[model samples]
Target: MASSSMLLSLFFTILLFFFLSPTLCANSQGNALHAMRSRLSDPNNIMQSWDPTLVNPCTWFHVTCDSNNNVLRLDLGNSNISGSLGPELGDLKHLQYLELYGNNLRGKIPDELGNLESLIGMDLYNNEFKGKIPESFGKLKSIRFLRLNDNKLTGSIPRELANLSNLKVIDVSNNDLCGTIPVDGPFANFHMESFKNNRLNGPELKGLVPYDFGC
Candidate 1:
């Protein structure tokens, strides 16, 4: 009788854990957003709904959540919120769109953002960001548009980005990037204007002066 009771208890415990997992994940997503707000300077007070006391961020403004309360997008573009991006952003595993373009945000682009496997579009253009593009961005299998133009970024473009088969728009113009432009995969369909004004010498030459030509 005791053995049967113990097995029943274990089963209920496992079931309870599974039942509460979604809420727990939602709480984590909310925490991640709160952390992000804490790092940025929101002079407009537009993020008033980002109270950490909330159980989840589903009801928060500028944030969109799915039916299961998972974060899907961050619509903070052109909000003029300055300050560096936080690594906490990576915690939004279900995030799809990251729109923070045309801001005064400065500092290195967080490598942690590459962890957003569900990411479809990422726009960080016209910011003051610097440093090399994170090579881990190649892991975004669902990515379509990657606009990082008009920043202070330098170094060679990651060849791994060319591996994204779902890529539709790839604009790295008006930056300080170098190396020969990739001519393979989705990069082959991109416009030259996409790579214009960068230090990139030319398209990839199979057996010539190497891929990092001018860098």
Candidate 2:
């Protein structure tokens, strides 16, 4: 009986270790998160609450994690974060929601953001970002909401963006964007509000209907 119990104990120990290995690997991924943190110049120190010494990013305010302890959301809206997007953000392979609206973030959206295959929602509106939307954003197949409105971005809307098969909402209004607006796929159903106040010229766009954009 003693020998039999010993064998069972060993089996259970092995099972526990196997189940915990993935968690260990994810926890050690702190280096990647730290790299992302180091690149941005947080002028207001709002992110000072994100202490690496904490048990996990899950515990950090504004950070959310999934069942596997992988980062799922990072909402830093209205935080006044300034600077360019660092390539290290690509390391967050499981990120699903990223909200950085109402900030002073400048520069173009990073092409590396396409690496986040699991992303579903992205909001970077009301900022000072410039440059064209990266062609690589077409790869965000799982994205459902993408809002980049009320910015200073300039350039033609990329036809490649129509590749988001699951996109339901996309707001690119109040920018300096021009050229033919992509119509077809999910984009065909969106109202004029989605592309309002732009220099877009296309039969696909009917222009913004009369509506008071009251403050």
Q: In candidate 2, what are the lDDT values of residues 89-155, reduced to their tens digit?
A: 7778889998989988888888988888999999999998999888888889899999999998888
Please provide TM-scores, in order, for all candidate models, with all chains considered together. Answer: 0.95, 0.80
Model 2 residue runs over 4 Å out of place are: 1-20, 204-215
State how far residue 215 of model 2 sits from its true place (Å).
31
Work out candidate 1's RMSD over C-alphas.
Answer: 1.4
| Predicted candidate 1 versus true structure: per-residue lDDT over 12-123, tens digit per residue | 9999999888889999999988988888998988798898888789999999999899999999899979999889999999999999999999999999999999999999
Weakest lDDT window of 10 consecutive positions for candidate 2: 206-215
**Candidate 2 global CA lDDT score:** 0.81
Model 1 worst lDDT run, 10 consecutive residues: 205-214
